[model samples]
Target: MAGPLLDIEGLNVDFLTDQGWVTVVRDVSLSVAPGETVGLVGESGSGKTITSLSVMRLVPDPPGRITGGSIRFDGRDLLTLPERAMRQVRGNDIAMVFQESMTSLNPAFTIGDQIAEAVRHHLGLGRRAAVDRAVEVLDLVGIPAPRDRVDHYPHEFSGGMRQRAAIAMALACEPRLLIADEPTTALDVTVQAQVLELLRSLQQRLGMAMLFITHNLGVVADVCDRVSVMYAGQVVEVADVVDLFEAPAHPYTEGLLRSMPQLGVRGEPLATIPGNPPLPWAMPEGCRFHPRCPYATDACRSGAPALTERGGGHFSRCLRLAEIELTGAV
Candidate 1:
């Protein structure tokens, strides 16, 4: 209905290495609408994190740079924004919650102080007002005794509590877009579920658009409205969550779904995708995923397929979209 809150088109990122400048993210495109959650699912080194980092203009230059494409957020091109303007956009309009809470938080500072800094910077609140704002946000995130907990350092909190603190800091400015990079990866199963539920509730309460980056399809199923599957350096498929789970169109998407460990099959070996993802410096010609694609044909090795529509907003990149009937995760 409404236009995408954040739209990325033809995004290309390169990294300088001993060999040369090799593209790590190529012609990638995706979007997130207001109040919607979109999952970017892929294995390590698939360029998922790179894409998100580029959005915040936090990509480490020299070693990493976004060479092409545009990141349009709420009608403005973020890539072209001046640094001072971008800084305002970073923690205020757009915020990121990294996977590791310990790394994201500062052990030296009190959790309240850390959150208060962002509120003071973005909202331009005075010290007392900022601390009060921090307590309110901590309470919003379901942390107990927010007034007292705010004075505690990072080490004083447990893993899950630290994560909640990280989230509180991100939401302190009430950002329009929240980029969460595997926020639940380090937690146990029960904690993971709690965190996921927390994120869902917060998103609904705040009405913020979320770009959830994770390799876990199960999390995608529970939290994301739409899913984008990335491999090598390209997006191979995009679909609605229910449609993707019921009828995945691409071989790569099918492989990922089939590889998910099913609950009742305890004795059987877990299905796996053969061969590792190719290195960015030495990517294969044509379709980047052809090497690991079970249904790849000669055409697949000759030229990369553009993402083509498979009806009802489901798009897939494959030479055999018609001939193949891929299995679904459900």
Candidate 2:
């Protein structure tokens, strides 16, 4: 089997706040094989978005920075690359569909123009060629009347259509990897499903690896081949979708799965983790999830457990992996 297309190792991101430099993303590592989809799932403050932003070298400076680790894509270390060289990587080799489509699209420019700008900037195509490429991608993403709608402003399009346009822009350059950060967060359930399906279809069609960042486990099960669960700036579990669902190793993973709304369980309250995620600067002494974990022990309060492999690419960051049996999504 071929090696991974995008490999991240020991990634640490820090922010300069009132409390000095606080690590917001700690020792994170994951990879995406060629033509594979990997889901990064976690609650809001789990650093999913920060991890994805670090890959593109898009973490804002002055406030945030990549303090440690390597981001390697296609055998190149992205962290060491010069800014100009990194620019070539962004939008050309890797494109990101951000959380909010409306904010992502420029209101002043037409949809076609925004896409064409990216195509022209990255691929160096002529204006006419870029416009044609924009039309082609819009049509490819299933937007109706592409040639005419291409001239429409962001306000002119509906929410779903705007989201599709953002995707079209991302796909215009035909990047090798796509980073989707909570792409369906703002849409209704139906539109979210449609967008998820569209993303699945596009990945299959383009044969591009994807890093899908979301808190939605149901969506992760539907679209992801592998899953990485993050909590309080660290990855707690990594497994194949089936393995993670059938036998969750980490307590946090189990909690997330159990908390999901299951079908045919009407009126039953959804399960939830006891406490909120800890703040980055004021992180706990030992395991970050210990305070909220149901099965935590005195040992869990003093020492952090390493993310250990349990054979067959399944891993968990729990000291009691062998001692406790956790329920899965199934």
TM-score of 1: 0.98
Q: All candidates' TM-scores?
A: 0.98, 0.99
Local distance difference test, candidate 1? 0.94
Clashes of each: 0, 0
Model 1 residue-pair collision total: 0
**Which residue runs of candidate 2 sit more than 4 Å off their true CA positions?**
none
RMSD (CA, Å), each prediction:
0.8, 0.7
Clashes by residue pair, model 2: none
lDDT of 2 by residue, 1-330 (tens): 479999999999999999999999999999999999999999998999999999999998879999899999999999999999999999999999998997889999999999999999999999999999999999998999999999999999999999999999999999999999999998999999999999999999999999999999999999999999999999999999999999999999999999999889999789888878999999998888999999999999999999999889999999988999898878
lDDT of 1 by residue, 150-254 (tens): 999999999999999999999999999999999999888998999999999999999999999999999999999999999988999999999999999988888
Off by over 4 Å in 1: none
